[model samples]
Target: MIAPAQGGLRVTAVDSLAAGEGIVPGLPIADARALLPYLAVREADPCADAEALARLAGWCGRYSPLVALDGADGLLLDITGCAHLFGGEDILLADLTRRLTGFGLTLRAALADTPAAAWAWAHAGPGGVLPVGVARQALAPLPVAALRLPDGMAAALGRLGLRRIGDLMDLPRAPLTARFGDAVARRLDLVLGRASEPIAPLHQPAPFRRQLAFAEPIGTRGDIDRALEHLLDGLLVDLDQAGQGLRRCEFSVFTVDGGVQRIGIGTARPSRERRHVLRLFAERLEEIDPGFGIEVMTLEAPVAEILPAQQAALEGGPATGEAELARLVDRLQQRLGRHAVVRLEPVDSHIPERAVTLVPALAPPSHRPWMVEQPRPLRLLPSPELIEVTAMVPDDPPLTFRWRTVLHRVAQTEGPERLSPEWWRDRPGTRLRDYYWVEDLEGRRYWLYREGAYGEPRAPRWYMHGLF
Candidate 1:
C-alpha cells in the first residue's frame, strides 16, 4: 500500500473508472469496495513485483553499469557518458522509453541536473526534461507532500495552509527549523538540487560485457576469430580488477541477425592468467559459427573460485608440475561433458559401496590417501543383495550360504566383522544387515549379508552382493 518512491500512501494505481473513483494505495480493501460498490482487488505479490524490477534493471544495464534500484517499481540509471553511445541524452531517453513501452511497461521518465530533482519531478510533476535551473521551478508547483515527509508532517503542514512546495520555499529557515526540524530543510535542499545525493549502484555487477560495432560483418569463424582476442582482452581487464579467477567460462558471439552461438570451457584449476585463460578457450574456437556475420562478442565467467598457488615439492615428490595431468583431464572432460571424467573419493562408511563415491573433478587433484583399515572388494554390486545363510544367529560367520541359486558350502570363512545397521541415519527404507567374507571351492571370494538376522517370514531370500 506504500508508494515506495515518496514513502507515502499516494496515487499508486487506478481503475478504468474516472481517475478519482476513490481508488488509491493504502485505501483499505473493505473501504474501497464500500466506496466503489464494484471494486476488484487482488493481494500484492512482493516476489512477482521484485522479479519484474530485476528484469527492468537488467535491461537498464545496456544504458549503464551504474544502475541502482530506484524503488519497488522504478530503476535509476546513471547514464553519464553512456548516453553519447546512443547519440545524445534526449535521443537516448526517447529510445529507452520507446523500447520499454514496446515491451509492455508504462514508464514515467524525467531528466535533470541531479538524481533527486529528476526523481522528484518524475514522482510528482509529470514526466519531462527539466534542464538545470528549470528543475526547481517545475518541482515547486507540485504538492508540499512531494518532499517525502511523513503523514504527521504532511497533515500538520496542510493544516497550516502551506500546501505547496513554492509556498514554503522562501519562508524563514529558522521558523521551519524550530517547528518542522532540520530534516525538512535537508529534504527541501535535496529536491531543489542544492545537496549532492550519491547514487549507490548494485554491487559488482558483471562488467565483462562488451559490444563491438562492425563496419563489415564477418560470416566465418575465422573472421570473428580476429576480433575474439580483443573482446577477451577487455574481459581480462574486468576480471583482473575484480580479482577473480575462473574455472569455467562461456563465450557468446552475437550476430547481426539476432542469433547467438555459445562456446564453453572448464579448467582443472581456477586461473586468472591471461595466457592460461586464452589456452583453455583455444580448444573450442573451431565450433563458433559466425552465422550472418557476428557484430559482438561477450566473454563471461559463470563459475570461479580462489586458487592458491601450491608448492609441489613440499610433499617429497620431484619438482614437476601437474600441468600435463590437468591438460589431459580437461581434454577428456571437454569431449565427454562434466560427468564423463570423474575421480573416486573415499567416504567414511563400513558398507563397501558406501565407502567410495565418484565426484566430478573441477579443481586440481588433492594428494590425500584413500581411507585405510577397512579391506575393500575389487568390485561392488549396485546394491547389497540379501543372502540366505546357515549361521549362528546374533554372532559369528556363516558355515554355509545360498546366493543366486548357487549354494556355496563355505570352504573357509572369516568375519562376523560385525557390520551393524546404520540406524542413526533414520534411513526408513534400509533394512538391517549382517555380513560374512567367504571363499568358495573355485578360489573366488564372495561378500554376502543376511537382510535381517532373527528368523522372519519369506525366510531370507538370498542374493549375490559382491565379488573380490
Candidate 2:
C-alpha cells in the first residue's frame, strides 16, 4: 500500500493472491484489510521501479533498437522495418510476450499504426494485432478512459451519457469542444489515427552493429576472440563505407544460461583501424567470463564521428606523431581507469584556488592563455591551510610565520595583492583577502593570505594558500 494525496493510505498495487480475493489497486487500505486480515503490504519504491523499467527497456533492444517507456509500467517499441526479421508482427509479439512472461511479468501487447491506438487497444481489448486501416473500428468499443484523458475529464464525459468512445465519435465537435475544451477532440483524433503520435526511444539507435549466433555454444577464450574478430570485420566495413570512425564500441556476449556480459572500449580520437580497436579490447578481454558457454556475440558502435578522406604526403612520409600520442593515451586509459588519466587546464578566474582545473586527458585544450603578469605558484592546495603570522599593523608581507607546526623566518618577500570577493554574490562573512609571496631562509617559496580587514571586530587570520 502507498499513501495517496487524500491524506490516507490506498492500495497502489496488489499481488495475484490479493486480486483473487477481490482486492485491486486504488482500494482503501482499511477496506482491503477488512476483506483479507492477513494481506501482506509494503510501501512502493517508484525510483527502483523506474530503474527496473529502464533496464527492461534496454533488454528489449534485442528485439528492436527503438524501445521507449510508455508510462511507469508500459513500453513502446517502434518495429516498423524490423518486423520482417522475426517472421511477422504476430510472431514477434508472441515471442516478446512469452519471453517477458518467463521472467514473471504479466504483459499486454497490441499493434496499430499509431501509438495512441496501440496503447488504447492494449489496455481495453484482448491483446492482438490491429491492422493498419482499422483503428476506428478497433477503438469504437473501448471506454473514454482509453483515450488517456485527465480523470476529471473522463468523469465529466461519463456523466454526459458519453460512456463509449463510439458515442463521442459521431457527436458534433463544437459542443464537445465547448464543454470539455480541445483535449476531447485532440485525443479523439489521436486514437482514431487522424493525428500522428511519435514514440521517443529511450536510447538513440546505433548507426552500426554486427551480430553472430553460433549453431553450438562455445566457452573457450579462443572462440570468443574469433567471434569478436568476425563481428568487428563486418562493423569496420560499414564504418569504412560511410566514411566514419568509431569513437566507442561495446561488445556483448550472450551466454546459454541467459546472461549477458559486455565489454566497452573508448578511443582518444576517432578511428577505423581494425588492429588498433582490437588491441584496445585485447587488454580487457580476459575480464569476460563465458558462464554456461557463449551463444551469441554482438559488436556495436554507439558513438562515431565523421572521418574525412586523408591524402598521403608527396614523399609518403610517416603518419602524424599526434595520432600515435593519442593512441598511447587511449591505451594508458584502457589499462588504468578513465579518472587515472587527466590534464590540467586553466580556468578563467582571478582567485588563486580557482585558477586551474583538472580535465579529461583527451579533452581539447583551453583556447584562453594563462595570466602571466603575476607570479603564480606551481601547485595550489585544495584549500588554504590556516597559519599564525607576525607582520606590520597596516598591510605588509609577513615577517615570520608558523605553519603545520613548523616556524619559518622570512628572507625575501613581495607586496600584499588585495583581492575582494565578488560583490554580486554578496553573503555574510565574505571579505577581502590580502595575498603575498614570500621566501623563507631555506629558499622555500610560499603563498600566504590574510582574510578580512586587519582592524575588524574579528581580527584578521592568516593562511598558507600555495607552494612554488
Maximum-lDDT candidate? 2
TM-scores of the models, in the order given: 0.66, 0.78
* CA error at residue 394 for candidate 2, angstroms: 8.7
Taking the tens digit of each residue's C-alpha lDDT, what string does model 2 give over 211-265? Answer: 7767688889888888889999999989988988999999987766556678899
Q: Rate the local accuracy (lDDT) of all candidates.
A: 0.69, 0.85
Worst 10 residues of 2 by lDDT: 309-318
Per-residue lDDT of 1-468 in model 1, one digit per residue for the tens? Answer: 323334423334554472478676656555566787765555556688898787667546556767888768778888777767777888878877786777667788987777877777788888767776786678878887778786589788989998888888988899998998887788788888788788888734443455554656777756666576777677666666666667777776656544557788887766555555566667788777776676556666767775444432432334344665665677777777778988788777776667777887644446667776646567778976666667565455676777766777778867545466567663764655655678877777987765655555434443457789
Q: What is the lDDT of residue 368 in candidate 1?
A: 62
Question: What's model 2's overall lDDT?
Answer: 0.85
